[model samples]
Target: MSKPIFERDPSDPERQKINPALKLLLELGPLLVFFFGNARGEWIAERLPALAGIGGPIFIATALFMVATVIALAVSWALTRSLPIMPLVSGIVVLVFGALTLWLQDELFIKLKPTIINSIFGLLLLGGLLIFRVSLLRYVFDSAFNIDEEGWNKLTVRWGAYFLVMAVVNEIIWRNFSTDFWVAFKVWGFTPLAIAFTMAQMPLISRHSLDEEPAE
Candidate 1:
């Protein structure tokens, strides 16, 4: 029997058909906006004094950051129809936390938002494997590369732990560091760390790769 049209299967022919450059753009655009909004907060506030009452650069940045996130998600939906799973999760948290930060006029909420989201993701991914006997990693990565169930479990576990580490790191940085420093870490530090960690898993990925198989 054929798979449902909207269901994502690791072996789907169409899953492998995304435009690599566009995919990268979709992934990176909102992050760029976040960094830009944070970095340019003062300039933006100067041009629009109303933003000054928003508390500080970080607050202004958070507001614009939310706007940028919405735009990014909209673009993703326009391009892909379905939302990208990971970013969709993160975007929802952004909207929620960003709103709280704005409404409460507390930067702490915004600062802690990443920590909460990462912790939730870490626990969810890890708990999914433990309880359901399946790794959710396949949904995000199945299109790019195929892996055996064991490989999926291992990747999921590693990513889960990685998310926890990110949560801890975000907590440490935001609680103790300057807003500029945290924003820099948020934009620059995390992505490279994730990329490096992914590279470290190359052996496991190669071992289980179904790259050459015909779509099921």
Candidate 2:
């Protein structure tokens, strides 16, 4: 029996692979837009004046972020005919929270969006591991990497921990910091932290990697 199309590994021979750069862009594009938009929203609103209706810098940025997220998801779906699970989940949160932020003219909604997303993901991953005896990461990212069962379990645990930690960090930063600081951290700080953490997992990934194994 074959894996379902949705479960096909990203490295699977038959999948219509995206350019690696494009894939990265799709994943990070909306975030970059959000950060840039927030950082420059005042300047943007000043020139465009029409955007003044959006309320403030953070609100304008949230609006742009939502638009970018939608476009990214649409592009991914058009190319692959299936949305990647994690991005889809995140994008949905962005849209929902971003909308509330705009409609209410409140920045807290957008600020809390990351905290909520991370909490949900952490809980789901941990629940799947402890209660269901499964690595929930597989459901969201089976196609992104290949690992042995033990490696998958370890990787899932680490990611679950990381997600929860990130949730707490987001809460702390947003609650204590200025909006500009939060925006900067969201883009410049969190992105590098995530990248570094991913790099730190290279040993685990290589150790459990399926790519080098002989096919049956």
lDDT of 1 by residue, 121-165 (tens): 899889989998767777777656667888899999999999999
Per-model RMSD to reference: 3.9, 3.6
Candidate 1 to truth, TM = 0.86
User: In model 1, which runs have C-alpha deviations exceeding 4 angstroms?
Assistant: 1-17, 48-53, 213-216
* Distance from true location, Cα of 206 in model 1, Å: 1.0
For candidate 1, the lDDT comes to 0.81
TM-score list, all predictions: 0.86, 0.87
Evaluate all candidate structures by whole-model CA lDDT and list the values in order. Answer: 0.81, 0.85
Model 1, position 140: C-alpha lDDT score: 70
